[model samples]
Target chain A: MFSQRLSMALPYAILFAIAAWFFYLAGQFRFTPRGDNIGPDFWPRLALGAMMAICLVQGVRLVLTGRDDEPGLTEGFAAEDGAAPRSSLLLAAGVTLTLAYGALVTVLGFLIATFAFMVLFSYAGHLRAHRTIWLSSALGAGLIVILFQKVVYVSLPRGIPPFSHLTDLFLGLF
Target chain B: MDTLLQLGHGLLVCLQPFNLSMLMIGIALGMLVGVLPGLTLVMGVILVLPFTYQMDVASGIILLTAMYVAGTYGGAFTAILFGIPGEPIDVPLLWDGYKMARAGQPAEALGWTLIAAGGGGIISAIIMVALTEPLAEVALKFSSPEYFAVILFGLASVVALAQSSLANALISLCLGLVIATVGTDTTYGTSRFTFGLPILEDGIEFLVVMVGAYGVGEVLARLERGYAGAPVTQTATARTELPSWRQFAAIKWTFIRSTLLGNIIGIIPGAGATVASFVSYGVEGQVGRRKAQLGTGIPEGIVAPQSAATASVGGAMIPLFAIGIPGSGATAVILGAFMLKGIQPGPQVLLHSGELIYAIFASVFLGIFIMCVLGYFAIRPLVRILDFPEAVVSSFVMVFCFIGAFSIRSSVVDLWLMIAFGLVGYLFDRLRFPIAPLVLGVILGPLAEESFLNTMISFGNDWTVFFTRPISGTLMALTCLALVLPLLGALRHWLWPHDFEETPHSQGSP
Candidate 1:
């Protein structure tokens, strides 16, 4: 019960912190002294102030109710028995994979990085059929490359040195 | 008579081999997404958008309109066969659809959905064709103040109908507006929050945020739950058998009532098909002749929700074409498509591109017919689509997310921002914050700011122009009412906590 209440309070606290930071940022927003104008900072300031008030109301309600307002949220994230640890690991891996793919594309180019990511992701997802995994990844990556880079003419990244050669070879076929 | 001639011309355009093929592909994709749980109609539309960059404006709009029309009808597949609703808009289907399917009437249940969606969608499309022009003619007179006021009304409606707490919704909206203000100020040309990064000067892309939040963020959240759900067993065959004319005549009133109710709700910005379906279900229960038998696998329960859900598609297009405002998240993406195609969808578009607008209307009718036909004969294959595990589906979605993010400006920075927002979206989902308002805010924020700023400048910084102009004044009043009604409800809840039924504060339903 206490943990649920804390979980509810945590969001409000984070919102409050953001509100405070925006308030500080609002101080740096300079206004021009021409023609009685409200200036560029006006909308941001008003939005921030409104956000601060909303956060305060939410904080007060969380304090008074001592209950999470949305049960679906709690139910969705509170984790079922024995499901927490495994899911948590999966979530971490997913985030890491996503970030790694993003960074790798700049160095390894789009096709190679995407193919590698798909294979690893399929394996991690427990698709133990090796032939299926390899075929699907290759087909998916090849289609994406041909469609986006060649047909649509989107200027996808070509990596340095060795990866650049591979990217050129792939694009040459299309 | 001129409208008729123009519509005939539009029909000719729609029948072109290329456009017809695109429409079919769009409907098939829409049904695929709608039958699968966790793949929303909005996400389906967004993923398809990057593919449309190479197509002409008319074909692109047709493809999108086809998807939007078919998407609302496709969710009944999973909602009937399995207990799980494929989309939030299909929740009302679960009341009697799953029950009827389990009672060995799956074919009949599927037929009711087909009839309701088909009949209601066609009627709504006719109404859309008749109504959009007169509305745009009226909107032609609107100035900056009226535009600002209407945008405020749209934002207010979203917050008021939001499933999350009013405060949380407002906070999410304000955050979106702030993010929108990150780049150089449109009015003064001064950078606000770039923090020395050159890329920030161009501002964050709404598409990047949207693809991240709905696609990648959804996948992450599903992973957090260990991607656990019952594997669906497909029992339904290919054929759909509708009720007899006499049996359909018995529920004629329910069909008419729900269709009208849905059209009205769809015209209201922010309350999309999900809310329409839910409201129609509630109203049907309260007023229908078979109220007592609503949850007992009856035809009335299936008819009301499905008709209302489908009718809402036509209703949503009204605001988009008439006044340059999106009625729902899916339409917001359509609005983005319009902007990308360099066609501002407002009164001027009606004047300049009437043929294109008529073509979209024609596509809607074609899409409705094709969707009904496909839903009838393609049930078995669509049901088989659910056999793929959530893990594989989410992984593919992640790849799409990566491509979508990178395709916008081909910037690695955009990809990073997409990942960051994905994490933020996951947090918001876990905490039960509504993401819809955030999306609306991002899409509509700049327009609101530009309008408000322009109005102020035109009126010599007089803020009261928003309340002084006749149309603007009435809209401002409505905006206030929209904001205040929720606060009053909250106050009442606070004062007498036990007065209301203690239902779960569910996310993603009205």
Candidate 2:
């Protein structure tokens, strides 16, 4: 019961704070309504008010009635019936790679960047064999570039760092 | 004849060497994604959406729809071999199919399941093609008021049928509604929660929310469980490689019956494939199996649920084409793609672009036919992988969950948002909250709100319009009935005697 109190109520309070902060920020919107009745602020304010009211009610309800999900304190995190850490780490790594790849796509160039990304993921991340990673990555990059550039005519950047001669070559020829 | 001619054009587009290859690749990718635990059809679609941006309209859509069909079929592989279902829709299938596998007829179960699924898909696809035109005509009559009623009906059905406590499901819905309000107020064109983060201008993308809720949340839940893979058993039996015609014949009626049931149920928004699959499976069990024979591995039992589950693809598309309103989570993503393509998928499109609609209809049939042919040959090898240790697969699922969340809109903000929802999802899971209602709430919340506001503006804020409009009025009454009838039933059962409630399994008693 005590842990449940900390787990649920803490988030509720923090979320309320965040909501109020957002409401204040919404007030900064440039107000313009040439003819419409409700100004730009109208909906934002309404949302803020409704959110505050609901959150207030939720907080009050939790205080009045404790959560029924009382965990057995004796159950350690590992021994608890559920939980896998490797998946979380891998997922975190995947998110990092996606962001990095997106950020670096222009700089690294599409072909070079995407090839590196795939190779890294297949090898270091997924633990695929080196040869398999190289082959798959090369194939994946080649296919994507061919489809986007030659067929659909969607232009990806020849890329920023110009590390990829292949992308430059493709973009030049196509 | 005109529609058929349009499809001829679509075929020309689809039959392009690159487009055909992409479709095949997408189907394979869909199967791999679906085979993984924790990753859903929606995840597969979200992850692949970015790749399709470079494609033309027809090819892009062909790839996505192919993924949808293939993903649904892919889940049965996991369900049949291992007791663990890859998707919630396959849960009932796991109960019987796994039992059959355990009984040393893994091949038989796999073979029969493929037949049932293919059979159901083909039947429902035909029905969808036949019904799309008439259904579109009906959809043309709907206005904001009618949409408002339909949305309410949809929401209420979710609450009525969701797992866990009704209060919990309602709470999740409320939470979703709250989240849906976070972005700019579309009506007023003002930021609601930007907090100086430019990303908040769009609020949060629904794809991000879905990926976070299902993907990140699944990882968190798996981590909490300390789960490793289940032990692999011997590879499938010879019975699977050569399923007898008689076995196929025996389950043929059940396959058709479940397909019909799935199609009918899927037309109702909020009542998605999971419900259709489970209900069909249970109904078949009650009718076809003796009480004593229920738990044992019966080939017919596997057929009934698997067929019905896949049939939902055709059935679910009915409302999508008819009214432009999506019927389930995956369909919601399809709707999003339509919006991205500048195509509003409602009656106007049906009237003006009937050719395109028919092309899509034709593609659904052809897509299933292709998936069946491909899956039949691949299932033998795919089924053997059921014996792969769960830990590796589980970890892989976790990784995809994270990546899937991040890929939506390619924003780091969504990653944070996803983690936040993952925590929320975990809390909900612990407290017996129904995830589906929350998901449905998020999917349809904006539409519900917009329609309500629009109807108010049109009628001078008169609530009476909801009751006065012809289509809307009936729909409103039905929404009320959907909510009230279930409560009344529970009340009657409570006030009187009910042996069903006495059972321990009725812990999820609504």
Candidate 3:
């Protein structure tokens, strides 16, 4: 029960702190307000102030009641399926893979980075079929390259040196 | 006669081979997106936005709108056959649909869904055509204060209709507004939240926030559960067995009431198909002639939510096209599509681009007919989409998300921003904070702020001017009521829990 209360209160508490910090920043805007005009800080400050107040009220209510007033939309639906065994490690790996894919797309170019990400992500997702994984990743990456780069004209990043040269070579065939 | 003639011309435009082809592709893709568990209708629309960049505005709008129309019905197959709702709007279907399917009437259940979607969609399309012009005429009279009030009402309706904690919804909305306030202030040319990043000055694109939250964020959430609850066996064969004329005549009122109710809810900004379905089902429970028989494999139970859900598409388009405010999330994406194409949809759109407006209306009509036909004949293949591996599907979703983000400005920074927001979205989901308010906040925040500022400037900073103006005052009152009534209901439920029976709308409705 105590842990549940803590979980409920934690998000509100964190939001309150963040809202308070942003509120302070809102006051330190670099420009002064012109005559009769509301400053740029006004709208943001108003939003932040409301957020802080709601967080405080929610935090206090959670502490007193030890239960949320109601389940949120996501919470309600998520409960409908019942609790399944969750893998925090899998989630962490997924997040890492996604972030790495984002960071590497510009570095390794779209084709190589995307293909690698797809294979790794599918493996991380527990797809054990090696042939299926490799084949799908290659075909998927190639099709997307042609569609976005050649047909749609997105000008995807080609990366540096070897990767760029490889992408160019592949595109030359297309 | 004039409206009919205009509609005829619009039909002509839609019947053109290119436009017709786009519509067919859009409908097919929309059904696929809706059938998949990981791909949402709105995200599907968002993924298609980049592709629309190269097309003419008319074809672009047609494609997106067709997707919007078909997406509402595509999920019913999964809901009935597998007892898995492809979208939140399909949850109501599961109560009777899955039950009926289990009771050895799967094809009958599907047939009910088809009639409800087709009938409700067409009726609401007619209403949307009739109502949009007068509504636009009224909207043309609105000023900055009124616009701000309307937007406030939209934001408030979203929070009120949120199926969870109101406080969390409000906080999510506020956070979205704050995100919108990032970068240089549009009015004063002063930098607000850019910190020192050059990319921040141009402002965070709402599209990036949307793709990250809805697309990447959903994938992460599913990944955390190891993609649990994959439907293992296809128990029922995919086919629709249409109800007899006598059966339809018996539930004609259910059809009318649900379609009308859905259309009305759809016109209210921020309330979409999910809300319509839940609320209509709830209402049917209270007032339907066979209310006691609901959830017992009854046709009325299936029709109420399905009809309302489909009707909402037409209902949602009215505000998006007529008032420049999106009535639902999908319409918000459609609004974004318009803005991306250098078109601002509002009253003036009717005057200057009347043909385009009519074409959209005609497309909705034709799209509904085509969607129902597809739903009838193509159930087997659409359901087969569920057989694909979750990992492969999720990986492609991530790639589409990345490409979407990167293509926006061809900048790596936007990709990082999208990834960051994806994390935020996953966090929001785990914490039970609804993502709709956040996305809507980002989409509608600038309009809210700009209108508020413009109103202040026009009225010499007299904040009361918002209340003093007649229409703005009335809308402000409605906004307050929209915000307050939910809190009051919650309070009553808390203070006296037994008095308030658990309505369908109050449980997992969003």
Candidate 4:
């Protein structure tokens, strides 16, 4: 019972703490008021204050009612084909792979990073077709590179030496 | 007379080969996005934003606007034939649309959707073209105080109309406002929330926030669900059979009411097609002639929501074009696109870029026509996109999200920021905080601050000036009303629970 209540109350608690931190930081905004001009901290402080008050009220309501007052604005908008089986492990893997891709894109170039991310993420999403995964990922990555780089003229990251060479070679073909 | 002449010229511009092709491609891609359960219309529009970067501004806006227009209608096929709402806007269609299909009238249901979408969209486009100039003229008279009040009203409306707890929405909005406050202050040049990193000074782009939250965030949410909700079954006969004129005449009032309601909702900042669709259906329940038979495979049930959803695209464009305030998520991205091209949309845009404005207006009219034609002939191919594995589609979506973020400033920092926001988006979803308010806050926060600060500085820091000016005062009052009404409704619900028993088939998980 205690754990359940803690779990329910935790989101509000974290929100309150974050809002409080921002409010404090707002106080430290280094702005000297010139004439009638307000400081830069003014808007943020007002927003943060409102946030804190809202968190407090919501936290109290949660404790007293022991339930959310209403459904989320988007609560009932998911698929209606009944509940799907959830996999925490797959979610973790997806998040980890996405974050790793983001971190390594500059290091490994958009081509290599995107290709690897696509294959791994597809697998994480439960696709077991090995040939399809590799082929699609490679083709998808190649098409996107050409489309964005050559067609659209976006200067995509070319990465370090070997990967850079591969990207140039790929670019050279078209 | 002048508007007509300009519109004629605009049509000529739209008919140009390149612009025409963009419109066609945009509509087709939008339909595909709307048909695919994995891709939301806004995400699809965002994914397409980078490609528009190199195009002429007119072609670029046309592409996004065309997608926005078609997206509202494209989801109806899946919703009617398969019981899967391709977009949140189509959720309302599932009740009567799917039921009608189950009752062996899939073609009839799709017919109502096409007529409703086509009719409502064209009417709203007319209204948009007619009203935008006058609205922008009136907006030209607005000062900082009035602008601030309008922005506040928009923000408050988003919170009030939130189907969730008001407090959570408010918190989400406040968090977005805080996020917008990161980096250097525009007025004072003071670094804020930057933690001493050079990358932090330029501030977080709203595109990054949008792509991360709406794009990556959605993928993560679906991944957690293990992509469990594919369409139950496919229908062999998925073609649309448009309603006869006699059938359309019978429910003409439904079309009018829903179209007007959608345009109004679309004109209001913060509300979009989904709200317009849901609210129109609810209104139909209250006032529709066949109200009692709304969800029982009735034409009124399908027409009301589909019309309003499609019409909202035009309605949404009005505020975006006239006042420089985005009326929906998609329009906000359009606003970002306009800013990217160094073109601020407002009264000045009407004055200097009138031809471009008319070109966009023409595209809407032409795009709606093409959308209906395509919807009539291309139902089979569009529905076939569902055959692709969810895992594969999601992977491609992730790559698009990354490319979109990276190309914004070509900075790797933005990619990381996008991932971080993806997490925030997922958390918001899990926690039930609405994402719209957060996004709108980020987009409008700076405007709200600048306007408010300018008002304060202009009036010697007397904040009451906002309440003293007539227009600002009225807007402020409206903002208060928007905020309070939901609470009052909740209070009533709390006091009288049985009276507010959940409306059946009214709310769907989009």
Candidate 5:
């Protein structure tokens, strides 16, 4: 029942902070001088103000409607985590592997990093069957190689400097 | 007919060897993502976006459009077999479809669904082809005021009409508005939510928010029950086949009615497919003989929702091609594709680019035709994906999410942003917050903010400008009416006793 009021209110709390921050930031820009007398600051400040108003209204609505007696704040996140620790662990591993891949891709090159990422991430997630791992990794690498190299023409970095010469030569052979 | 001649040109563009192959690849892949639990059509299209980068705009568009049309229909598969809906819009489809499956008529139920879905798709295409040009011509006349009014209408329907307890929905709507307010206020270079982080300068990525709220949120929802519990049983049998001609003949009117209904509703900005699917089901249920009994695993229950869901595509495209507003989420990604090509999708899209519009018409219709052919034969092979193991696929999704975010700008910030959003989404789900409205906020935020800002600017910050413009004023009244009427009805129900007949009519749970 995430659809209930208080749960919705927490995110709004995040929004209120974001709006105040935006208003603070809006103070920094030089807005355009349109043909009309409307200054550049006009629109951004208005949006910020409206956002603030919407936030205030929503916060009041949540407070007015919150359950009169708070339920014992059950450790809901813990319950969900306890139920699916294995899947959650796999998800975390997947997240970690993806971040590592992102950090490594430019350094190692898209092909090497993506290939390693797909294989590792897939295996870490429980796709350990040999055919499954090889096939999916091949699919991932093929997507990068074909889609980027041929179709989109994105100039993905070759691996680190010394190895790049070989990578360029490899790409050229294709 | 000149229209017939134009179809061949579109076919030439769409049916090019590479494009045709891409279309096939897209449909197949689209179906996989569409049906799989956890992944979404938005993600399906987002993953397809990077592939579109270097192609001619036409081919690029068809590849994505093929996915849009197919993925919209593809969601029905899981809805039918497993009670778990792939997308929230498909939630309504599950009511009758899964019920029909358990009733031992899964074959006929699925068959009727296919016919209705295909029929709705075809009709929507016909409508799009015929009307996009005329609609765009009208859209060309729109000014900032009109755009503002339109966004206002869209925002109202989503935030105000989203759920029961108007107060709750509006609160969610406000949250979206706030997130949208983050990042650099475009008018000024001021950083709002950047939090001293460079990524904050861009504010929150809608993709991050979407994946967080839906993708990660869904994972948390699934995790809640524990994987140790029994998996929902599949109602499919190896012997299931197409419906008999007699059975199909009986629901001819239902098919036609749903197609028209879907197209009409799909045009309303922010009203979206989920609303259309549920509305069609309710109408058919009330009017169709099986209304009371339909969800008991029958053909009508399956056909009505399936067709209605598919029909939303055609319906949604009305605004997309006409005024450049996407009626639903999947099309919003398609709208992103349009923006990428430097093409403004509103009225001029149909006028200056009539052939392209016609070709897209022929292309989408042909794509749907191919979907029917494939859905008929391809499902068996598709179903086999289950045996492949889930971890591998979700992991690939995990990586793809990062790549998709990064490819937008080749920035690492987006990758981390996606992860952060995923965490936010996971927490949101655990906390019981609705995610779509937040997205609707993010997507609509800029539009609404810009429009309201411009309206105020034009009137020199006069609050009355919003209420003073005739078109704007009426809509404002309507917005007030929309917000107030529901609360009034809710209050009346609380204040006075009434028979079911005396109570106000409800649009039903979204």
Candidate 6:
């Protein structure tokens, strides 16, 4: 029962803490000494104050209402999951791939990084059909590269070797 | 008469091959995204935004507008045939739409949706064209104080009307405003929240926030669910079958009432198609002669929400073009598009970029026509497209998201920013915070700050100047009303909790 209550109270607590932190940050904002001047900090400070007040009220409401009320907004999606721990694991894996993809895109260039990311993402997504995975990933990456680099004229990272040469060749077609 | 002539000229612009192709492609993509669950029209617009960056402003706006128009109608196909709402806005259609399909009138249900979408869309487009010019004329007389008041009113209305708790909405909105303050202060020339990063000096790009939150974040949320919504099971197929002339005539009043309601709701900031569709459904349930028969596979049920949903598109565009305020998430992205093109939509937009404005208006009509045609012929193919695994779809969305993030400044950091926002967005989504206010905050925050500072400086720091000028005063009063009404409603709910049992809390979750 205490755990249940904690689950309900946690979201609001976090929100309140974040708001308080923002308020502290707002306080750190340097204000110019001009008389009657609302400095650059005015809007952020005002917004942070309002957020803190709202977060306080929300937290108070959760404590008073207890667990009988509908769960806090963040709680519903968790209950809907079939296996929460597994879902979290999957999400973690997805995020890791995403981060790795972001970090590696410039080094591995657009082509190799995207293809590898696509395959890993598909495999993570549990798509078992190897052909579908490779084909769709290839098509998606090719189309994106062409659309962005060729048509849209945005420069993509060219990587360190053969991949860079291919990216150059792709760009040359335009 | 002058409007007619200008509309004709706008028609000429839209007829250019490139513009026409963009419109068609936008419609096809819109329909595809609309039928797929977990993909929203706003996400569709955001994902497509990177491509638009390379095009002339006209083709880009035209493409996105076409998608916006078609998107409202595309979700209906899934709702009516599959009993699954492709998006939140399509939720209302499942009541009667699915019932009609299960009753073996799938074709008829689809036809009603098409008719309602087409008729209501055309009517709203006509009204949008007629209203925007006059509204802009009235707005042309306004100055900084009035602009600040109106923008404040916009922000307030969005926060107050959010289907979630007003507190959550405010928190989300304040978060956006704070994020908007991260760059060098244009007025004071000092950075407040940059924390000394060179990238922070330029400010966070609204597109990064938009694409990350709506696109990557949405994919992450769906991933958390393991893409666990009910799978599409039924494979029964039929062509769209139109009702008889008498049958169509029977539902004329439903169409008219829903269209008007949709337009009005659409024009209100923060109230977009989902609200319009649900409210139209509710109003129809309460009114009309056949109201008692609404939920049991009735034509009125299908007509009312579908028409209003499509009509809301026109309603959303009015504020966007007239006052440069985005009335919905999709319009907010379009606002980003306009700004990217170096066009600030307002009264001045109509004065200086009349051709582009009218061209967009013209595209709306043409889009509605093309959507109906494509929707008729492409239903079978779209259903096949939906059969693609959810994992694959999420993967595809992630790819586009990465590309979109990278294309922005070709900065690897933007990609990280997008992924970070995606996680934040996913958390926010789970937390039931309305993301719209956050996105709008990022877009409108700078403008609001600029306008407020300008007013303060011009008026010698007198705060009352906002309430002194007649137009600004009236707008300020309205903003107060907008904020107070919801608080009063919340107060009532708190005071009379027993009376509010089973009260449906609308989620502006998208």
Per-model DockQ against the true two-chain complex: 0.45, 0.13, 0.65, 0.68, 0.22, 0.43
Clashing pairs for model 5 are A2-B432, A22-B192, A29-B189, B99-B297, B100-B297, B136-B347, B194-B200, B212-B425, B266-B315
lDDT of 3 at B319: 90
Model 6 superposed RMSD (Cα): 3.0
Model 4 global lDDT (CA atoms, 0 to 1) = 0.88
Interface RMSD of candidate 4, in Å, is 2.0
For model 1, which pairs clash?
A: none
The list of candidate 1 runs beyond 4 A from truth reads: A1-7, A29-32, A68-86, A126-129, B235-238, B501-510
Model 5, B272-304: lDDT tens digits are 666677777778877886666756666666666
List model 1 lDDT by residue over B377-432, tens digit each: 88888878887666667677888888888877889999999898898888777766
If scored against the real structure, what TM-score would every candidate get? 0.95, 0.78, 0.96, 0.96, 0.82, 0.94
Candidate 6: give the clashing pairs. none
| DockQ winner, 4 or 6 | 4
Q: Of the candidates shown, which would achieve the greatest lDDT relative to the real structure? A: 3
In Å, residue B375's CA in model 4 sits off its true spot by 0.8
- lDDT score for residue B375 of model 6: 82
Instruction: Report the poorest 10 consecutive residues by lDDT, candidate 1 chain A.
Output: A73-82
> Which of the numbered candidates is closest to the native, going by highest DockQ?
4
TM-score of chain B of 5: 0.86
Cα lDDT of candidate 1 equals 0.83
* Candidate 3 local lDDT, A1-174, one digit each (tens): 877887879989999999999899889888866897889999999999999999999998888788666554334456765367778998999999988988888879999999999999999888888898899899999999999998878878999887899999999997
lDDT of 3 by residue, B1-510 (tens): 899999999999999998999899899988888788778899899888888888888899999999998999999999988888888888889888889999999999999999999999999999999999999999999999999999999999888877578888899999999999999988888887888898989899999999999899989988888877655476336799999999999999999999999999999888899888888988888889988888888898899999999999999999988889899989999998898888989999997999999999999999999999999999988898788788888889899999999888999999999999999999998887888899999988999999999998889999999899999999999999999988987787677766644553254222
Error of 1 at B114 (Å): 0.5
Model 6 / residue A129 / CA error / Å: 1.8
Candidate 4 per-residue C-alpha lDDT over A1-174 given as tens digits, one digit per residue, 9 for 90 to 100:
656766788899998998898899889888777875778898999999999998888787667666666543344664243378767898899999998897788878999999999999999988899998999999999999998898888888998988899989888999
